[model samples]
Target: MGNAAHEEVIASINSQISETNALINAALVAGTPTDKLRKKLATLHGDLKTAQEFEAAGIADEQAKDEAFVLGAGTEIAASTIAAVNAELEALGVVCRIEQGGDRFAEVAHRIAVALRIHEKVREKIGEAAAAVERLETRINECAARRATITAARLDGKSSDREVNEFVALAADIDALNGLLYDARAKLDGIDDSAEKAAVERLRADMQQLVSATLIEAVTVHVAQAEIALLDGIRKLHRTGLKHAPHRGSTPRSHYLMNADLDFFCRTGALR
Candidate 1:
């Protein structure tokens, strides 16, 4: 569903939850003997909180997918550019391996430094790609708003001076939006992939290292999903009123999580 539709449903659900909670509170105040209903409502509240956590987790998981895409794409661009330079060095029989014995270490380090420099260009290109996406997204949103306004004016059917002016503005906006869309598409299509693919064919240890680190970042996709599930469970228990509140446990487990994880990593240089 679209965001507006989802929001409408969420608002309705929230209203129901508030009404239920108020009813339970009123029953308690009036001595109406609604213990069973109170318990049921408590369970429903737990489930609602769980659903909210799931919703949050789902958003994080989706964002992880975007992050992985950007990092993976940027790494490929950097690796390929680095590989192209390495291939030329190989053709000239200049060994650039850091561990390959004598004086070559300096040259090898220099070459690696040069490859790292290419990463700066890679970063710039990545920034440009993000900016292009933002521009397209902004323009599309503006176009949608203008179209909605124009549609609303037409539906009114009065054809007043205000409506005529709105129609004129909408026409101008549509023209600008069309041009912006074309520019965004052209920028995306102009990205070269053949060079990146060629770099994969002639991969180096450094490129492998880069790819490995990028893959580690991609691992967050799964981590994000897992975190969502974990939070849902925690929220479920916490929302279950007095009976199942997580902190109510007599012997709460000492396993490090959240801020504890930060402390552990900072102190021990290890992640739990």
Candidate 2:
């Protein structure tokens, strides 16, 4: 399907899934008959499978592009200029880190340049992390819908053999999706500098303190630290791929809470 059509189908299916989940929730609370709920759930599963297939297809293309971009970015950064990094940051809505001093201007610029180099180097990992999170979200939503269907069936108190079988299947699906979501989140959290603002504040404080005592020395040290921090961010991106970082876990049942941020990166030219 063309991109527009694909998006439209996805939107329609998602709306249906939402409505189905709501129906399942109400049916469960009201103790609807297992057979009746099972029929509805069967339809929901069919739609969900279609949606999953579309997502799978899109992921194939996206992954290919991601691989190419990452490799190319690595090469580009090796010889990248400050202007290139500034352009990239501007595209990402990040302010360029340029120094406004006399003698330390070049040093500060070099530091920012290197940091952006690291940023470019890890760009693909960021894209992959975003994609993984999207996949996890879709799976989790589908599982939740399935879980609601199973719950509705159980509420009937006379679930048939088929319903029982489906319940077991849903259990396994939810378990697998939960694991995927956990891994996806760990990747994101590992690379996330959610504490970046605080870190910057500390650095600013230090720079101010050293302005009088040891101007050039403090600026050099701070620039080095900035480069090191950016390098560490890149290291974490690779380590996330190794799956060695601590798994702090995904968000709550409100999975869409993170999708907005992910969508921003995916939809914007950030991935470019």
Candidate 3:
């Protein structure tokens, strides 16, 4: 029966039960035999109980339907939320893969956290890589300028005190440049992608060649024997892999120079 009709049936049964009880009470007060009225009242109460049970069952059925609809809606929302978060991650050049199942709300929340973490890490690495490249390029230009200054001085095989002092100073500047390059290359360690790392390494190689060529030019200028020895020592140390010396008690300046010399030797064939 329709819900409204079923409710009407229950109300009708309850009204009959009440009327039967009133007739039974009236017959007893009139001192008449109440057996038939009492029997009718008992039958009405039984009918009322049956009707109420059916109504209770119908209400439970309706509640179940409502809960099912809500669950379906919740599932749809969870799916859309995951899709949106995945799209955002892809825009940031990251891929998010999540296995489906379990509590959907919890899964979506976890996916969002994972996507955010990946995006932040990639951004941080990219920034570091760019900064490292910039630093290396800047130091390369600075070294080039210093080399030009030394070239213009034109010592011409002279052994004068002033010529020796100038070569010594330039050697110190070259040392400083090497340290800067090393520090810049170290920053590349933060990048995890093989292709990106390889591209930066290639650029590092090119920069190393430019700087080593500058060193070769300086050596050919016939500076003091002592200054020549100093330049040669720098080359040999790098060539023989002494640049990877232990880091105990080393200052930042020393650490930067220590790792950069190897790149110079590797690119220039200075050992040959």
lDDT of 1 by residue, 1-272 (tens): 32334455566667777887788789889988877776767776776676666666666765676556555554555545555545655564544422222232233334444444444445556567668878877876876786677678678874578767776777787688778778877776676545644443444465456445434444555467677987676555445633554455533222223577766886899978
| Ranked by TM-score, top first | 3, 1, 2
- Per-residue CA lDDT of model 2 for 204-263, tens digit only, reads 354344343344454556667777986576566555644643353332222223246555
Model 3 residue 90 CA deviation (Å) reads 1.4
**Model 3 per-residue lDDT tens digits across residues 167-229:** 677668767867876776676765556554455455435434533553444344434554577
Best by TM-score: 3
What TM-score, computed on C-alpha atoms, does each candidate reach? 0.33, 0.30, 0.36
What are the Cα lDDT values of the candidates?
0.59, 0.60, 0.60
Q: For each candidate in turn, give its C-alpha RMSD to the true structure in angstroms.
A: 31.0, 30.8, 40.5
lDDT of 2 at 53: 85
lDDT of residue 98 for candidate 1:
21
